[model samples]
Target chain A: MIVSPTRRRLLIGSAATAAAALLGGCDALVDNQHVARVLEGAEALNKDLQRALLSDTTLAREYTEADMSPVFKANGTQHPEGDAYASLLDNGFADWRLTVDGKVDRPLSLSLAELKQLPARTQITRHDCVEGWSAIGKWTGVQLGTVLKTAGLNTDARYAVFHCADKYENTADGQYYESIDLVDAFHPQTILAYTMNDQNLPVAHGAPLRLRVERQLGYKHAKYIMRIEIVDSLKAIGRGRGGFWEDRGYEWYAGI
Target chain B: MFHPRSRSVGKPSSSDVAGATQKKLVFRHPLLVRLTHWMNVLCLFILLLSGLQIFNAHPSLYWGKYGADADPAFIDIRAYRDGNSIRGETRIGSLAIPTTGFLGASEYNGALSVRAFPSWLTIPSYRDLSTGRRWHFFFAWVFVLNGLAYVIYGIAAGHFRRKLVPNTNELAPSHLAHEIADHARLRFPKGDKARHYNTLQKLAYLSVIFVLLPLMVATGLTMSPAMDAAWPWLLDVFGGRQSARTIHFISATLIVGFVFVHVAMVLLSGVWNNLRSMVTGRYAIEVEKHP
Candidate 1:
């Protein structure tokens, strides 16, 4: 077909305009609560599928020291801003204690030294960030299962919520928290890592302690853990979404 | 009364009158194929846009097991401040290219912002990685399910064997060369020839359906840590999560290239006819006339 240049330009211009309008419409859809809820429904599907397909014994791919990244990037809160964390850092975390309470048979507060003494397990694993970068580091810590066993999880405990010291920037509550189901909480590879790359876990990488849930994204690995609360429901947690990032729209089940 | 060139062709039917070319309408696409094709169109459109939004979260690609800010990336899209101006730069190893007003940096909400991809290219047209992911995964499910249905229908119904798979003669180097020459000259097949997909078309469609699309899905799944645990072999197959991510990006780029060529071919061959075939399952082709 033969078309005049002017007519072709008009058609192209209208097409561009239409595309812009479509984009605007998409933005509106993004903000719509109903659409957001429907999209969030995939999280349950992914969680269920992964839970059904993977055995509890299935471990995340462990790497050799040679496979580790030369430099592991410190993401999110490098140094928490609080008098409690500041004093703990000043004393080399000597006074810092991780309290295991809430829906546990025995509530206990264990010091860093005590945590290190609770049968340490070391494994080199990759840390995948939600922003599409990865870093592999060797972590040494006691398995969460061991600690949960020591404290004795209550029969009704459906989830283990990790409350951290560092507050994510821009968040109204300023609390960094994450939660995982019983299957992941008791996973053999899931550990409370206090050492990274054969050294004391640097404050930049979440000093004192960090939860390393290997099967999930980095955000699920709560850092500078101050408390582990066993809970039947996450409705009372920060914004009731389970995690700090989750409250901000990140999927609670970040298996993907 | 017929032209000399038409004498050697097939016998003219009642539709051919006064030596004029005759047009025949055929049901080109099946109902299932048409439905799946349009669904894929929607899925791919949303997936690409949302995928770009997700990619913008960390605008870099790398190799091997792990990659982050400290690690060197093969492709890095970032912006740097230059006195009064901000410069968008795309760096590949030793080579650096200024890509202002586009990659690395672009205007968002009337102000120049640092982002890997421009706002217009991404879904929501904003920097919401969470929402972007939601859109991507939701549409991705639709895409995969639709693709699975199409493939099953194609195989069970002989669509792949009869329509997509090129014959031995078409596979010959000389025939392929002729088809390439014809395509280059914009000489599309006519009449009965147009009823079936050309050899080039068959190969392109087959590769996209069987190879590229599957590769995309596999690589995408490899990036998921949960999937990695459930199926450790995916990590071995892709060489690592980082490598899988890079492959996924490359495959998406190739798919985009295919879409461009596919659209161009449709426009060049016969826009309305191609559109009708896909949308309404009807196509018009000129009939070869004979004396």
Candidate 2:
């Protein structure tokens, strides 16, 4: 059957309108709180499945020096905007100390030189960002497990939360923070990286120290680390979502 | 002595008239196939939209071990302001092409918005990467589960062996040429011939089932850091995470292309009949009457 030009135009227009309505409906569905909760279930599933499949000791692939990217992009906060971090930066972080408290047998405070003195590990690994980019760099630091052991982690400490100096986007609740469970916290590759590419960690790339949870995405690897809080649960942390990006609706367990 | 080709010439049911051309209802798609087919349709639709939304977060693809803003990109979609007007451009390697209305920049909520793949094509229809990711991952699980069910059912029911795999004769050069010519002329099979999938159809279905879908899943897993730790071979298999991302995008685009062609073919060659068969598992085919 032949469709007249005007009739065809009307049909096309209606189809377009219907499609737009459908998309609008999808937006509504996405905005629904129940739907959001249902979708969030996948994150837990992913985490559980990944942990079940891979051993706690299974390391992320370590690349060679040649494999490292020529320029590693420093994303999120380049330089924390505050006099507190600025003064610390000015003094070369000599006075800066990483306080390891919360659910710990020994509430220890260690300086950068002291951290360096306590067994360091250097490894080259790929950093995968949530923005769909990757950069390979050599990281040198004391393993988080070593640090936790030195601080005497309590048996009830289930999660290790990293509090950073930088405030991402300079928002009220953007004090950059991240958390990882005991499985990642004790992983050999999980380190408080104090150096990148054999040099002291650049300010743009989280000066002083950064948490390198290699198995997780970049957001989980909180930079500009100032403190480590060992906790039994993430419920008391920033918005109770475990991390800054998590509070902003990003998945807490970003295994995928 | 009944000929194999003469199966359609057999006795007709009571509905057949003496003078009118004979028509028979053949049970084509089984229940499992129909169920899975529709489920897959929904899964794929959600996946594509949500995936595009995720891709818009970066709007570029790269290769090798590492890539970012500092590193060169293989494909980049960007928008720039041009004297009070905004222009969108897509760059592939060194070549840049203006793609204003459809990609890079497009109309969102009645205003020109800078985004890759436009608002209408995305799940949330806005620049929300978090929500997009939630949708993508949720539906990804659904797609994977649906695909696994389909494959298992296809294998157990002999669906692949009985229908999808083409015989040696159909694979012959002359037969392939003939089929290509027939397809070019928009000539579809008829009568008993239509009862089975044509060689091209078999190849297309098999490739999608075996090659494209598996590649999509594998490359997708490669992009995950935890998965990489679990299965480091995935990184080696796809070159690297960035390379895997590129491959994932390419595979998804191919799937989209496949959908368009598949839909057009269905519409072109007996849309209602095909639709009914898929829905109800009964297909109507015309049979020539013997004198």
Best candidate per lDDT, number? Answer: 1
Ten-residue region with minimum lDDT total, candidate 1 chain B: B1-10
In the range A1-256, model 1's lDDT, one tens digit per residue, is 2234787788679879987777778888888999998988888888889989999889999999999999999999999997988999999999998999999999999998898888989999999999999999999999999999989988899999999998886567768999999989889899999999999999999998999999999999999999999999999988999999998889999999
Per-residue lDDT of A81-182 in model 2, one digit per residue for the tens?
889999999999999999999999999899999999989999999999998899999999999999888889878889999999988866677788999999
Q: What C-alpha lDDT do the candidate models reach, one value each?
A: 0.90, 0.89
Clashing pairs in 1: none
Model 1 CA deviation exceeding 4 Å by range: A1-21, A170-172, B1-18, B289-291
Give DockQ per model, in order: 0.60, 0.59
Q: Report the Cα interface RMSD of each model, rounded to 1 decimal.
A: 3.5, 3.7
Query: Which residues of candidate 2, in runs, are more than 4 Å off?
Result: A1-21, A169-171, B1-20
lDDT of 1 at B96: 100
